[model samples]
Target: MSVQDSAETAVLVSEWRDLLARHAATACALDRELSERFGLCMSDFEVLERLAEAAEALRVQELAEKVHLSQSALSRLIGRLEKAGLVQRAMCEADRRGIYVTLSAAGDERYQAARPLHREVLARSLAGHRPAGG
Candidate 1:
C-alpha cells in the first residue's frame, strides 16, 4: 500500500476506533435479538440484570453508576420501565430525596429469558474479532 493509504487505514483502525467498532457490532446484535424476543433494549436488559444482582432495591444514583447512564437518563429509562410494569420505583423512607429502583417479577422473568440469547450473541459477535494489528 502507498504510505498515504497505509496511514489512512491505520487511522481508521486505531485502537479506540477498533474498540468502539467491536462494541457497536456486539451491541447491535444483542439489541436486535433482545428487542425482537423480549421487547427489551440493551439498556433495558442491563438495568434489569443489575437490579437482579442487587440484594435490595438500589438507589437511583447507584444503579445509574452501575449501568453507566447519567442520572437523568436513568430516571427516564426507569420511567419507561415503570410504565411498562417491568420495574418499580419508590422514594426512600430514610431519605425522602433519594429514590430506589427494583426489578419487578416481570423484569426478572424477561432478564432470565433473555440471558441465554444475550450470551449467545456476545459470543457469536465477538468470535474471531480482534483489534487491528493484534
Candidate 2:
C-alpha cells in the first residue's frame, strides 16, 4: 500500500477506536445507573427500549435486526425478560418458526422511568465528543 493509504488507514482505525470507547463508556454508565435505579442491565434496557418503540409485537427476526446481539443471545435475553414479566413472546401464526416479542405493561413503565437517566447518561458521556466525520 502507498504511504498515504497507510496513514489514512491508521487515522480511520484511531477514529473508530475512539467511537467504540465512547460507546463502551456510555454503556457502562447506563448499566450502572439502570441497575442501581431499576435492577436492569444495559441489554435489558435496550431490549425494553426497542420493544417500547414498536407499535405492536415485533418478529424475533426483526428485533434481532434492531439489536446488537446474535439470535441465540437475544433469545436468552428475551427469556429472562419474559421470566421477569417485562416482555411477552408468542409464536407467529403464519410462521411456526417465527416468534413475536412485545413489551409488557411493567416493561413499558420501567422504560419510561429510566428514559431520563438513560438520556442524561448519554449526554454526560458524550458531552464533549464529536463524531469522526463531523
Candidate 3:
C-alpha cells in the first residue's frame, strides 16, 4: 500500500476505536443511571427492550444472540428477571426442549419507564459525534 493508503487506514482504525470508546462510556453512564433510578442494569434494560419488540416469545438461544450475551450468561440473566417477575419462561410448543422467554406486564412497565432514559442517553451521546450537516 502507498503511504497515503497507510495513513488513511490508520485514521479509519482510530475513528473506529473512538466510536467504540464512546459507546462504552455512554453505556456505562446509562447503566449507572438506570441502576440508580430504576434498579435495572444495562443488560436488563436491553433484554426487556428486545423482548418488548419481539412479536412473540423469543427462544433462549435467539434472545442470547440478540442481546450479545453467551447462552449460559443469558440463562442466568433470565433467571434473575424471572425471579423478579419481569419475565417468564415457557417451553416452545413445537420444540419441547426449547425454552422461550416472554416479557411480563411488569417487565413492559419497567421497559416503558426506562425507554426514555435510554433514548436520551443515546441521543445526547450521538449528537456530539454527528457531522455538521449530514
Candidate 4:
C-alpha cells in the first residue's frame, strides 16, 4: 500500500474503533442493567417487544428483517424463546413452509413488565444528547 493511503486507512480504522467501542459500552451497560432489573436479555427483550407490537404473528423472514439478524440466527433465537414459553410457532396457512411466530401471553406480560425499565434506561441514556428542537 502507498504510505499516505495506509496512514489514512489507519486513522479511519482508529476513529471507527472508538465509535464502535463507545456504542458497545453504552449497550453493554444498558443490557446489564436490564438483566439485573428485569431478568431479560437484550435479545429476548427485543424479540418479545417486536412480537407484542405486531397486530398478527410475524413470519420468520419478517422478524429477521426487523431484528437485523440472519435467518439462521433468528431461527435459533426463536427456538430459545419457544423453549422459554415466551413464543409459539405455527405454520403459515397460505405458505405451509413459512413459519409464523407469535408472543405468548406470558411473553406479553414479561414485555409489559420490562417496558418501564427499558424506557427509563433508554431515555436516561439519550436525554443528554437530544437535539435542541428535536
**Which residue runs does candidate 3 get wrong by more than 4 Å?**
131-134
**What are the per-residue Cα lDDT tens digits for candidate 1 across 1-134?**
99999998898789679789889988888889999999988999999999999999999999999999999999999999999999999999999999999999988988899999998998888877755874
Best by TM-score: 3
Clashing pairs in 1: none
Each model's lDDT comes to 0.92, 0.92, 0.94, 0.86
The number of residue pairs in model 3 that clash at the backbone is: 0
lDDT of 1: 0.92
Tens-digit per-residue lDDT, 27-48, candidate 4: 7866898789877777778889
Q: Candidate 4: where are CA atoms >4 Å away?
A: 1-19
Give the Å error, residue 125, model 3. 1.6
In candidate 1, stretches whose alpha carbon ends up further than 4 angstroms from where it belongs are 1-13, 129-134
Better of 1 and 2 by TM-score: 2
In terms of lDDT, the poorest run of 10 residues in model 3 is 125-134
lDDT of 3 at 109: 99
Instruction: Report each candidate's C-alpha RMSD, comma-separated, in the order given.
Output: 4.1, 2.1, 1.8, 3.2
Name the TM-score of candidate 1: 0.85
Among these predicted structures, which one has the highest lDDT? 3
Clashing pairs in 3: none
Give, for candidate 2, the lowest lDDT window spanning 10 residues. 125-134
Lowest-sum lDDT 10-residue window in model 4: 122-131
